[model samples]
Target chain A: MTPQLEILITVVIVSSACAALGVFLILRKMAMMTDAISHTILLGIVIAFFITKSLTSPFLIIGAACMGVFTVYLTEMLKRTRLMAEDSAIGIVFPFLFSIAIILITKYAGNTHLDVDSVLLGELVFVPFDRLVVFGRDIGAKSLYVMGTILLINMLFIAVFYKELKLATFDAALASVLGFSPVFIHYALMGLVSITAVGAFESVGSILVIAFMIGPPVTAYMLTDQLKKMLILSILIGIVNAIVGYWISAILDVSIAGSIATIIGITYLFAFIFAPKRGILAMIHLRRVQQIEYAVKSLLFHLYNHEGTDIEKEESNRHSIYKHLHWDKRFLERVLKKAARRDYLSVNKEYLKLTPEGRKYAIKSYEVL
Target chain B: MMFLESLLRDYTLQIVALGSVILGAVSGILGSFAVLRKQSLLGDAVSHAALPGIAFVFLLTGVKKTEMLLLGALISGLIGAFIIISIDRYTRIKFDSALGLILSSFFGLGLVLLTYIQKRPNANQAGLETFIFGQASTLLKRDVYIMIALGGIILLVVGLFWKELKLFCFDCEFGKSIGFSDTKINLILSSITVLAIIIGLQSVGVILMSALLISPGVAARQWTDKLSCMVILASVFGMVSGVVGTLISSSVAHMPTGPVIVMVISVIMFFSLLFATKRGILWRYIKTRRDSRDINECKILINLYESALNHEEVRHAHKTTMLKPIKSLHYLRDKGYIRRDYLNTWVITDLGMEKARNSIDKNRGERV
Candidate 1:
């Protein structure tokens, strides 16, 4: 396979893996925690590297993954302290840890190919060079195998504990009462998120890692409400993002990871503005339609209330009804026109009267509301 | 003394340190309000969002003017915030999803612009990456002045609107009930908070600047419940961290000032979390432990007293086997409230009986 194929596969595997766990993370309201984990794990990788003195050592992955879990642990500890809010706890802890890692790199490891720049703003251009050779055969990029395994592990964990995870994620109290430990499930899922971050950020950078992790799942969430469908949609979106981002970067000669993140943003914006049922335009249209319907009903109700009353002339006059309802005159007129068009009301001289159909509609709306 | 003399003498150190101090203090004062309103993560989002603005300015003007770049940053940050608000208000999508999405996507666009600039043949783009992982040693005198001016303006705005801001932060519904426009006040406070985050973006980098905006307030809140005191304390903590971080990083060979300052403020926050008097983890733990032990001893004492009432004597000996052992009974014994009559029996004294009556009444939750 060409280097281009290798890079594409790496991004696809990483995106899907991150998105797989992201569904659970966003559901648990831990989006920012993943942000914190992505940064703080740098410190873990740095310290682990200092000990092992090798970038390819599995210990580095273990150490970084542990640090990701440690980030969650510290944030939770600070939150349990109750001195600050949850986001403050995250905002405080990760930077502190990441800064120390950064300080170590700049001060001591400056000459060791371990600068802050490359770790944070990852470079996927170098993926082809780091080939994994088995028995003198150049198989593929190392990231391909690593991220692929992580993706498989994510799917397996989610699949094996599907029942427990679903119960725990939606209703932890019930899960615990039913002899399944939600806290145990919570930490295990976090551990998977950590391992995935360890693998993914090496290619996509940390910030874009957040995009890949959260963007696809959230976009999927916009389209569907079912968990099974959300997971499948998330992976599908991740694959599309990887390919489109790759094409943009290739055409423009820009950062591939960055272009992917930008693409993710554009896709989400498109969905947010034009999704079938939940799109912004659709919602605005729905509100407008509902408003006109509501206005017609209220007009009918108002006319029905004033029929045969001593103040009917003042209260039920078509031109003066806006003052009583506190609605705009133009809006009232529009509603009146719509009502007359629909045969819900008619004008007798200058006063408004509800027809039989309008009376029935008004009573039904009152009962339904 | 030597460091202070050098700090006074070294022009670059003086400028960077001064800039750090102002950025730190301003962020702290505004951060108290941010944390109070639970908008602590807004700093992270806004700072990250400011990147594209900075990049866009550099791309257009081909100059790295701090003022122009910051103007771009301010514009884009506002746009990003507007997008976040619209997405949150209009869609079923969660606020955090919107926040994470906009920040990362904007930063990504900024990265694209930056790489596009890097590919261009321009020496003027030398220190542009410093905004990502800020290099304080590179701060110019003019940059420090800009920091001071912006910091001063923010402080003034915070002061002029302190009353309305306090009400909005604490009780927006009550403020609205009494006829203050909650939306307008919220907009003003949030804009200034964004300004604070923007000013620090040049010195602390995009990712870690949120720490500067959030840490001091969190630390100050541990010590004081009053907003005024919390703001004051936060500024002091911010300034101290800023100055000390500058000093430490200057002494080191290749230390980046941003992360070091983040480390210092974090240390301060950790200390506050652990040791502050009123709400510190240590004090809260001690109070809980003492109260729990009190409840345990009171239960045993009440048991012994109630049993004594069934008998003729006010102080009756009871066998130890029937009751679970209370470890703090030694506390009662030391106070001469209860005594061990034999190896297996215990008796309540008159003092113990009176204490048990009080404990029962207290546990009953009301009294005459």
Candidate 2:
């Protein structure tokens, strides 16, 4: 296969894995923790490289996963201390680790091919060039295999423990009484998150890794209330972002990771504005239209149901009534036109008459109002 | 020691250290309010959000003065914060989601702009990259004076509004009920936070400055419960980290100062997490162990009572046999809760009887 096809396949696989595990992270409010893991993984990979003396060593994934777990452990430890909240602990721990990584890279690895920039921001275009070989036969990109395996692992774990994870995530205290170990579920979910981060970082870089993990899941959450629907939507969103973001970057000659992140952001914005139930714009429009409809019906009903005056004079002197009601003139005219179209009122040179159907409708509205 | 003295003698190093001290103290004072309000992450988000602002200013004016760039940064940072607050107020999205959205977008925009600027032919754009990860070694005497003046003004304003800030942070509704305008207080607090970020940006940069703000406050929180003392202790911690990080970075060749300062602050936070008396990991561990032991002892006492009631000869179960269980009974007796008779049997003393009755009463009362 061509290198472009290989890169596209690799992006799809890695993004799918990230999106799959991202659902749990977003639900648990651990998006920033993924950001922390992405940064701290650099320190782990660097240290592992120093020990193994090979960038391709399997220890790289193990070391990075260990550091990811350590990040969560430290966060929990700090939170239990009642001194720092979760966010502050994350803010403190990851940067120090990242700094150490940078310091090491500058001091010892500056001349080496392995540097901070490469580890932190992997080159997606060059991913296909790093081929994996089996018994002297060339296989596809190495990142594809790694990410695919992690994705399979994630799927199996989620399938087997779906009920337990759902219960624990929604309510941990209740889960504990039901004989489910919340801590066990938490650690298992975090472990999956760590492995996914390590795998995706190799192809998509750290910054885009967060966007893949958080953006799709959060957008999916906004679009659906059902967990199963959310998962499906998240995967679909992830795949679409990968394909469209890659094409956009290729056409526009921009950074691949930045383009992908921007696409995810745009998709999220779209969901925020257009989702049927929760969309902000939809709700605002619905409220305004309802208000306008109510105002028109109320004006027509009052004109038809006057108790002490002739309806003709009242309709002719609409402006005098408008002064008392303090309603806008344009609004009054629009309501009058709507009433005439509905056969509720007929307007002629500022005089009006109501039909029998109009009188009945007016009485119903008057009683309801 | 002599090498340290020689290192401190360098004018550039001295100036950077002094400037970092001022920056650290201001951040500490403002961050106390941020942490109390559960808006600690706001500092991080706003600082990252300032990147686009700085880049836009540079793009438009071709100016690189610290004051002009920071002014643009403050405006953009405030805009970012406003967006975050508005999203939180208007949408169903939680504060965390809004924070993530603003942080990523603003920082991404900044990065795009910075990359564009790098491709241009402007030599002055060289130090602009330092704002990502700061380098304090380049600070001059003028920067030091500016930091001191800014730090002093922030501290003075914070001092004057200390009581109002406390009321606002702990309970805004109550503050409003008592005739305080929560909106005005919030404006004051946020302005101080923005100023603190601007001053510290020159020293610790954007990404790591939030760490500087929050870590010291966290450490101080472990040490004290009072807000006033916590603020002072946090300032001291921040100052110490700044001084040490600056001194070390200057002594070592090619060491960036921002990360070192963050590392130093993290170390203090680590220590506080483990060792603080009022609220620390070690204390909680000890307290939990002690409580567990007390629970086990109560369980054993109740077990003995049940077993004694099962005896056939003693109608009221006033005595027990001497077995391994009796060993614990003897131990309790030595602690002045039980008595041993000449017949090698255990019996409850008056104090022991009263204690058992009280335990039963308390347990039943709790259940009800």
**DockQ of every candidate structure:** 0.73, 0.28
Candidate 1 error regions (>4 Å): B175-183, B318-330, B333-354, B365-368
Candidate 1: residue B333 Cα off by (Å): 4.9
| Cα shift from native, residue B108, model 1 (Å) | 0.5
Error of 2 at A38 (Å): 1.0
Q: What is candidate 1's CA lDDT for residue B343?
A: 79
Which has the greatest DockQ? Answer: 1
Candidate 2 scores a C-alpha RMSD against the true structure in Å of 6.0
The residue pairs found clashing in candidate 2 are none
Would you estimate the TM-scores of all the predictions?
0.95, 0.79
Residue B38 lDDT, candidate 2, scale 0-100: 79
Q: What is candidate 2's CAPRI-style docking category based on DockQ?
A: acceptable
Query: How would you encode candidate 2's per-residue C-alpha lDDT over B301-361 as one tens digit per residue?
Result: 6655555557664323344543345556656777766666666666555666567667878
How badly does each model clash, as a count of residue pairs?
0, 0
Per-model CA lDDT versus the true structure: 0.86, 0.78
